[model samples]
Target chain A: MEDVKVFGLWSSPFTQRVIWALKLKGVSYEYYGEDLANKSNMLLKYNPIYKKVPVFVHNGKPLAESMVIVEYIEETWSQMPLLSQDAYERSNVRFWSKFIEDKSMQMMEFFVYDGERQERAIKETLETLRVIENQSGLNEKMFIGGNTIGLADIALGWVAHTLPVMEEIVGVKFITTDAFPNLHSWVKNFLEIPAVKNNLPPHELLVEYYREKRKVFLAMAFHHHHRH
Target chain B: MEDVKVFGLWSSPFTQRVIWALKLKGVSYEYYGEDLANKSNMLLKYNPIYKKVPVFVHNGKPLAESMVIVEYIEETWSQMPLLSQDAYERSNVRFWSKFIEDKSMQMMEFFVYDGERQERAIKETLETLRVIENQSGLNEKMFIGGNTIGLADIALGWVAHTLPVMEEIVGVKFITTDAFPNLHSWVKNFLEIPAVKNNLPPHELLVEYYREKRKVFLAMAFHHHHRH
Candidate 1:
């Protein structure tokens, strides 16, 4: 048996990215749900730098960062290819994957924030979605890269799960069929994947978790905005 | 002959990354100096997404984003391998490379800004350097991954070149022999690479360019900071 263990938070979209990739590759691993408030010493030891959850340990070697771990999984297990065989094609997909990874944090900020800052975050989020709609080849393909599910789709997997929860909490809808036709269709295709579909956290649990988080975040933001 | 062309600003560290990679591969190309104030139609056409410099064109195909372009160059011309051959090793180097890429913009911010923001940026830059000095394999090896100058080194090449210039303008010096002994040594190792040595922009010119840019940046930051 492979000695694979993962320290993660069930509700974290970042952790879910790793879960989906591992499942897609049919790689078996033991999962540990961590309390973010009191993260385990092992989690701190495994990732001294970030000290966050989703630490993927394979045969005792630890790796942190979700996309990095996902790429590592792709390399370690060739059973299901997350990227392309051709270099040009691979670079193209990597570009989109990196793009999504870079944008994900800012894109999700609105849900946690409120007032003018949330409005700014919403505007930036729409701009990011608009760029993808106008620039990415989603009109021609099912996924971000091509007809098949790939790394970019995996990188974007969080949007399907987290974005909606955020939208509900903030009372704003971003991905309408009219504004983002391709993304609407792409989200449907992404969620249809068994690996992605099966591994997501229960919606009610996630709403509860983020609802509490949003309160803390807004309290912090309120103090920050009013600072003299 | 391979039809390779590069759209770049002579002062851009990102553009220099592409140049160093090309030189290492012994590839020939035409270099176009872009007036960033007024970008050419060709540059805009080649890279419509960001419309930034370091737009690399090879055999009529255009690739943007410096690291993305560098990876493409690595794939296209296998003469000078920027990455390790083994999958695990490649992932390791790429992990560091991505880490650096994510932090690059913030690291460069202090040089362009003034007041408390610059102090914060300086602190962060030192923290970043401290992490690399302690975490990266500099005590055992000359470069980031190993003795050989690889992709991570190339991605970090700007720090070796542009950082000093920024320091000169900002009246602060980082990467001293005492403060960062390993990085101090690594800087010597990186600069010794013939490709890197041969391709840097004239220092006086970069100082002049960045001095002008710093003035503009501080002015914008001043206005941004005072906004109601």
Candidate 2:
């Protein structure tokens, strides 16, 4: 009895990464949609450190962190390999994956604040995007690491679906053909994958969710600025 | 016919991690000490994104990031496994490794700054340590993951050696017998390892180097504060 489970929030890109990986690997597991405002006891029990969503459990053992869970899923199930068979190629994929994962939170700065800070954040985000465009092997291959969608693609999965929502909310465009042509194409290619295409949360719902969340973030930022 | 080379700095904890992993696996390689002030063209070509140290080259293909290189070493050579053969245990080790790696820079904030910032940073560092001491499986096992030294140990290896130097320079102590007994013991166990003990940079030189670096950091901080 293969008892696998994922505790996640639907609109979260982190959560979606795990869901998409599971789907890609054809692993059927129970899904528990977590309410972040009021987290479940199971989540708290599973991940005492972070207590964040995308906690993957197999049999009785639990795992946290989206990319970690995705890697676990890939390793546990042999079908639909996300990383390459070659050690060097696998390391290359991991290098890009770590790069994007480390920057994932910082890349959302544009949507979280406004005015001069937003402009600065936008520049930083673009700088990171530019690095991805130029250095991440996107020109030679369709995906970030290689021709096929792999770990780097999954690590960067949020940009395809959630980044557009953030872009719309912030009213600033990134990943355009003129600015980041390679990323623009890679984004299209990533979304076209059946596992990714089918597993995404509804676009309108995501936009609405993030729009409200952005308002909260801006309000907190305003309060923080005033307090300082 | 094996070709393995490491481009690294002697004192950098990140670079030391790769070196220690190699030593632990008994994989001998040529080491090139990089001067951060004037990084080599090879380092630039190998890791253009960060232009950083600890670039591991195996058969001419270069890999960047300390933990990433460590993982590559673990995969390439299976002699003394840094991770568990069991999937769940490996994920657990990864979780703690990721946690420590993410907080590694932030934990150094106490050493980087002074006054109120240092206090706050110290508190943050203590909080992180508390989490590790209480939550991580250190109570049951001799190391972070299990009885043997593994990836998490290598990931948190800096804390064992370098943190003491930072503490000595800054005149503050963490991981004491009273504060973090588990980590205190873990530190003792980590240092006892042949790979770790033999591969460490000389202590007095490290202290002198960091003392100089800290002065520069403080000066930069003073200038930035005045400018703002």
Candidate 3:
């Protein structure tokens, strides 16, 4: 039996990325939910540097970083490949994955502010989605990389679920078919995957959780603004 | 015959990563030096999204982002492997590589600013170095993740070369032996590698180039400040 364990947070998109990857690969592992307010000692011990969730341990060795863990899962289990066999295709997937992950935090800016700042964030978010719609080859494929779900798809999975919750809280919509036809179709296809569809956290609970979290984030941002 | 070509800037650390990785693998390719002010049409066609070098082309397929290109080089050619074969060790290398690369841009802030902002950047740079010195296992090995040169080392290779040039211009030094003994030693070991040693841009020329570039960056920052 493989001794695999994952320390994660329930509502974290980063944690969901790991869970969805493992489910896609059909790897069974113990899951330990972490409280960000009071992180577990084991979680701290496993990932002292980041002290964050989705710390994966396999056969006694521990790994941090969600994408790093996902890539390791792909490397260790050859059951369902998250990347491509062709080196060129794999690099293409990786390039898009990096691009998406790098922008993930910034994408949340739309939900974190109001007024002109929020409008700027929304415009930037739309611009990013526009790039994905046109440039990521989504026009040709069902998913980010190809017809089959892959690493880039998992990297971008947050857009299908968490992004909607954020949009709901902010009373704004981003991925309409008129504006982002390819991404509109891509989101629907991504959510249709059994691994991704079945494994997501409850939508209502996510909305409630983020609603409260957004209050705190906005308050913090306001405080920061006043200080500056 | 391999059709390999690198579109790069001679003074760019990002471009140097691709060059070093190729040299480490003993791969030969034609090099095209890009003029940032007058970027080539081929370069723009190759990487339309970022439109930046080093854009690597192998057998006519083009790739952008320096680290992404370096990874492709590692994946394609098996000679003088830049990443560990073991998945666990490879994950470790990748984690540190991501950490360092994520901070690389911020690390240059000290060079771009003066007075308080520069001091803050310097302090943050030291904190980052301190984390690597104590936590990244440089105390146990000659390079990051192992005793041999690998991806993380290449990711961090900028610090060994370009950082010194920036420091010379700004009159601020980081990674002194007294402050970062492990990194100081690692720098020596990294540069001692014939691939890294021989392929570096001429130091005096790099110094001259960046000296002029810094003046422009400072002027731009000052202009932006006055506008605000």
lDDT of 1: 0.90
Superior by TM-score: candidate 1 or candidate 2: 2
Please report the TM-score between candidate 1 and the true structure: 0.97
Q: Say which candidate scores most in lDDT.
A: 3
What fraction of native interface contacts does model 1 preserve?
Answer: 0.53
Docking class of 3: high
lDDT of 1 by residue, A16-81 (tens): 999999999998899998998899999999988889988999888788889889989998898879
Q: Give fnat of each prediction, in order.
A: 0.53, 0.91, 0.88
Identify the runs in model 2 with alpha carbons over 4 angstroms from their true place.
none
Residues A1-228 of candidate 3 have per-residue lDDT tens digits of 799999998899999999999999999999999999999999999999889998999999999999999999999999989888999999999999999989998998988888788999998998888889999999999987788999999999999999999999989999999989999999999999899999999999999999999999899889988898
DockQ versus reference, model 1: 0.66
DockQ of each model vs. true complex: 0.66, 0.90, 0.90
In candidate 1, clashing pairs total 0
Residue B164, model 3: Cα distance from true site in angstroms: 0.6
Give candidate 2's chain B TM-score: 0.99
The alpha-carbon deviation from the true structure for residue B15 of candidate 3, after best TM-score superposition, in angstroms, is 0.2
Q: Which residue pairs show backbone clashes in model 1?
A: none
